[model samples]
Target: MALRTGPGSPGPGAAARLVVVGTACVLLAACSPPAPPQVPAPAPSTESAGPTTVEPTADPWADVSDFVPGLVTWDSALPEQSVEGDPVEISLGEGEDPVGSFRRTNVGLSFEASDLADERWEPGTSSLTPLIAALNQPSLRFGGNAVDRRVWWTSSDESAPDWAEFTIGPDDLDRIARFAEATDASVTLVLPLGHFDPERAADMAAHAERALGDRLVAVAFGNEPNGFHHQSQLDLALRDEGWDAEAWVGEAEDYGQAVHDRVPELAVDGPGAYDAPWWRAFGEAEIENKVALSQHWYPLWSCPDRSGETEERAEPEVENLTSQWLHERAETVFGQGKDTADNYDLPLWIEETGPTSCPGTNDSSRTHAQTLWTADFVMIGAAVGAQRMNHHSSLAACRGGAPMSMVCGMGAVPNESPRVIAQSNYLALLMLSQVGTGELVEISSSDPEVRAYAVAGEGYTDIVLVDTGEPGTDRAMDLSVDADRLHGISTLTAESLEATNEGRLRLLSEADAVPDSLPRGSVTLLRFSDE
Candidate 1:
């Protein structure tokens, strides 16, 4: 990996992330460098509780050493790797396009419809609701595989559809509406396509509309119609054999039209396909009131049968958490979807996505690797122009059968878990949450292993650097800048990159620590005033 030593002299190749570093810092008296970033000892679970414990660490970088005026050097442990980086010599000026904002519509969390029923969502009673609010009220999306396999329009005591896991009645939607309101977010529900009854789908939308009112942003049909044929439980309930994209889109539109007939102008989102062709098919189709293009992706699914596996990416056991292949695949997959969405001038949405869709892969998905991955995923989502990059989560345990969400539910029972567990990976959100909402600014990096991005918010531009390589346990790259890198930075803090199994972060400042090369297998975010 090389550095952009000078202009026109770029590093890495086309396959690498297109990122940039802060060229100059606007040093104001208020923008004084806070402190050198350090990894604080892991604190026990203080948020809520449900068997959430901090994975202990060796505290490798605990000792302070002398450093050059501009160079940072040492062993890294991931963030809490010690908080700090070198600010590169660059700036966002005229003619540079600011990418999308991390807003409610753009950044959010997802859940299964039945999962909502598993808890008591009466006002301030639900533990998850408060945490959802902490995410600054990002959009709350309901619908997953459950939409197609587990949902019914009304609460039913009868034989219930063989596929029904739970009934989602008007009352349920009513409670959900209240919950969403309490969380300060909007709602998007994916209706069932398994039943194949346009009227039933329409009826479901009407009930949701009656309950959610203006809070209901849009409605989507089916979870992932392209893969319906693969799941037996959903296969029998869906269209008969020979249900290709052509057939799928036709029926998908039928359901859309049916719902729109009753609730005129109710925005609709669709396909929810996991493949490329399906996205293109939906993009080409002329559906009424189509708002955003949607898809589901699992970048780190450890299923032995999952495609793109090689000796490097073995299953069950965690693969290279910071591999180039992992980052490249994300760039390619999301890039393709973005192209389809762009062709139609629609906003692409990753309706469901995470480290792994399969459960019990805690060895892989639940680690700090996910924290690094989540940071990279956010930058990728911004660069690719995705409108909603909602990380799918479950109230189920993170230690559940497999790894899926950053926010994991604990306890043997469903929502009965004494406390909901927020995994270490969630630190990515907490870090970025600093810049409530902002437009993405591109980062130009000469290093392949290290990719960076800047989010230019109202008064600040946050520079994020992520290391996609294995740990350099012996060496720490002290990135140095010559002049004026903190020009516009008002109040600043820094975190060095280091990977650790421990889930802890202390927002303390050391000295005049401002920003560059971070601890390997870690990520860094530098906040600057855009003055």
Candidate 2:
């Protein structure tokens, strides 16, 4: 007497139980509601959930396709929307020819050499290892302002000049070397040029090579040497005047010559300057010892002190992270380096760069704005013809730490556990690693806010969409790709753009593969694979 209504009235096992219950109810004469009118059992259909009238309306893609849940949507296509017949068209060539490969260490970390000297690294085991190793492949370069200001390089003899305040010994070098191996990263050792000593240079290079072996990629001679003249400290200043590109070239040549004289096989990268004139001069000089030309950069600075000649930048702000000016500034400045590198036939490396210079725990440097900026900035580096880039990092206290550090530790360098913590912006580095090493493809977008970058690999293509618009702003993109080539789609996004220790990653592909409101101030990675 129990009315059963569903896709299937009842299975055999279910019917058996129902029969037993009905018999007991009848015997007791207590069947509820006097048993409703008998109804026929509905047969189950395997072909479809039998036709139930569905109401539909103006949504064109309502019945187009079911959106595969999660980050991946396989065997499907996204509905492309057009803003008045204008949509961002992305063109991926036949996967055979690639302009160039975006190598494994294309995106890396830059650290001040003094950090190593400070014993901040606890090689083999540290909270920093997991995050770095997660990138699969990365490079860590130790060199920065501290190298000239306070740090000194001591080789086997363990010697330092009278002016040297702190010395980086074999122990420190070994610590960073061990860390690089632990994190599966390459090492680039930077030696100070403020006081050039050929013997010291060779000794440091030899020590780095012995400790790092093939893992040692480059022995850089300087860190933003162009700006050394601006250092207010009397001891830090390399030259009072006539410290131009030609002068840097001569000094770099001298350092390069000394290092190679003792360690001929060691690769050298140099002239780490924020300005481009040094790059031109170094390239023009054709410094034979140089394997790559590097430049350190920070679009803006939080520090109040600066040289009178240098133009004053607008105050460092979180909003500036995604500003058009930032991107243009990077392109314009790095474009010069790229041109010189190409002219000289050497690779251009952005050895030091981040959200800002010495942010010292600035809120803007640790926020989601930095995360989004990282996406835009890394792509800009790629587009600007940079062979590789190192985003600067620091664990020193905010006062000593730098701007745009991926993770900032509460305790000073050499702090114990519970003090080292990652910033929310680290999501940016994790996101960049997803693309891995692949050939970059061409993308054409009218709207710059939703920047598009595609990486073509063996049997797959990764498309990274960086939307820098605000939360309430409309950042919908009519992404055009070879739909037929899309076998599966994998994309991940954070729950919210605000600061949160706990990261919540979710898929944002719309049911029809088209959404009016994509997550603002977020990065979306889509992988199209043959499998």
Candidate 3:
């Protein structure tokens, strides 16, 4: 392994400044220094949660100490290693055209109506807002599959919807509006559509508009309206009304128009379909009120008995969470949404999505593997032209064998067992936010086992790399950075991809270090100076 050094140029204040990494410090000696060195511990490399290093003690060509040691020298050049297996070669083009831009609000979280109606939504003691802020203040979506059946109550005279159990009222919307305000995020509320009522949706829209102001991005009329046509009771109701793709589109338009009449500026988004066919049909329809095309996605169906069980069974195994599976899914899922959106001249937003379509998968969703999968998911979603990808998190607790709850239900006390904390997906969102928003560029990877995505903006370029090889294997990739100096480096890894911790999602963060050998099932993000 070779550790390449720069042409020995002195950095500003090179003698006085010290960077702390772990417990070690490296002296920045450019030439024969004139002043005494104030050696500080090495600074942390970017916001990576992986192994860190300290400066090497011997000559630049001296024996390479442990690279993954608690501390290794990193001053002028990054640590490099020899090729282990077939190295994944990544090449970034020096093109002026950007493939896409990363949206800070691109990643979002979804909640159920009952979550907002909880008593714990007080001003000071609220756990929801803190958790939202922790997750990078992602756009909040109120309503999941439960929204289709949940009823909103404004007055006593109005009868509840047939599926109404927990009545969500104006106060609940107030709580949602308040939560959105605190988190500095836009709110996308899903209206009941299985039992469609334009009046009810319109009133709620008017209230939300007043409370949320511009924070209310859009109003989705239903949750998976296309799939609703298959439900026994829902099918009978829709059949009586002659409900189909075209009809659903018209209904969405009508409901959206009614909401517009109440609040003229609030935009509408929907059919929230599970497949591409419905998206195409919705796009092809004459309805034009939608500001953004919305859809749902799940890489695999892990919970077999969940609602609308599909025959295509792909379990959420650690092995299945690979570069190829993610690559294909990104190409296919985002491709369909982007194509449909382009056809209709609208932005594509994944209103609801997750690692596993069902609630949770024991093997992967609960483990560190979700972090890698989520990084790929977000980056791929951005690369494919989708503006937002809202990861669906049930407001309720994990029931049965499912464990996909981002927060362990509303009213969860802090410091309590299973307290409301950020989940694996939340960590992924935070990492991307720390990486910063920029123009996403094209990054070609030579090896199929290694995937790379780059973002160029804010006078820096960030390259996110992931090694999707199986256990007991490591991937070494040569990355070319067109820059005068390498500034930031970090990696995200664990004991293994399948590892998980109780009370909290067990994860670790090391100081600054450049990764030369990407261990199996790990993700790393590297930042380089443009100059």
Q: Give the residue spans of candidate 3 off by over 4 A.
A: 1-83, 94-98, 120-124, 155-162, 231-242, 284-289, 302-313, 359-361, 398-402, 409-418, 476-484, 501-518
Model 3: weakest 10-residue lDDT segment is: 60-69
lDDT to native, each model: 0.58, 0.58, 0.57
Q: For every model shown, what is its TM-score relative to the native structure?
A: 0.75, 0.74, 0.75
Q: What C-alpha lDDT, on a 0 to 100 scale, does residue 495 get in candidate 1?
A: 32
Residues 1-531 of candidate 3 have per-residue lDDT tens digits of: 111112221223212222212212222332221221122233211111121111111221112121111122343333343435533445555222334567656667777754566654543344545556544436677767667766554533466656677677767677666766655567788877767778877887788777777677777887887766565335324335455787787777778677777877677777687767778766765543567788888777645564554543366676666648656766687877888888887888888888776443467766666767777888888777777778877545433323665555323332222224445555566556545456676566666666677776544456676666553444433343212234555555555667652111111122233333434565666654443
Candidate scoring better on lDDT of 1 and 3 = 1
What number of backbone clashes does candidate 2 have, counting pairs of residues 3 or more apart or in separate chains?
A: 1
As for lDDT, the candidate ahead, 2 or 3, is 2
Cα lDDT for residue 315, model 1?
43
Ordered list by TM-score, greatest first:
1, 3, 2
In candidate 2, position 345 carries an lDDT of: 76
**Runs off by more than 4 Å, candidate 2:** 1-100, 118-122, 156-165, 231-236, 301-314, 358-363, 398-400, 476-517
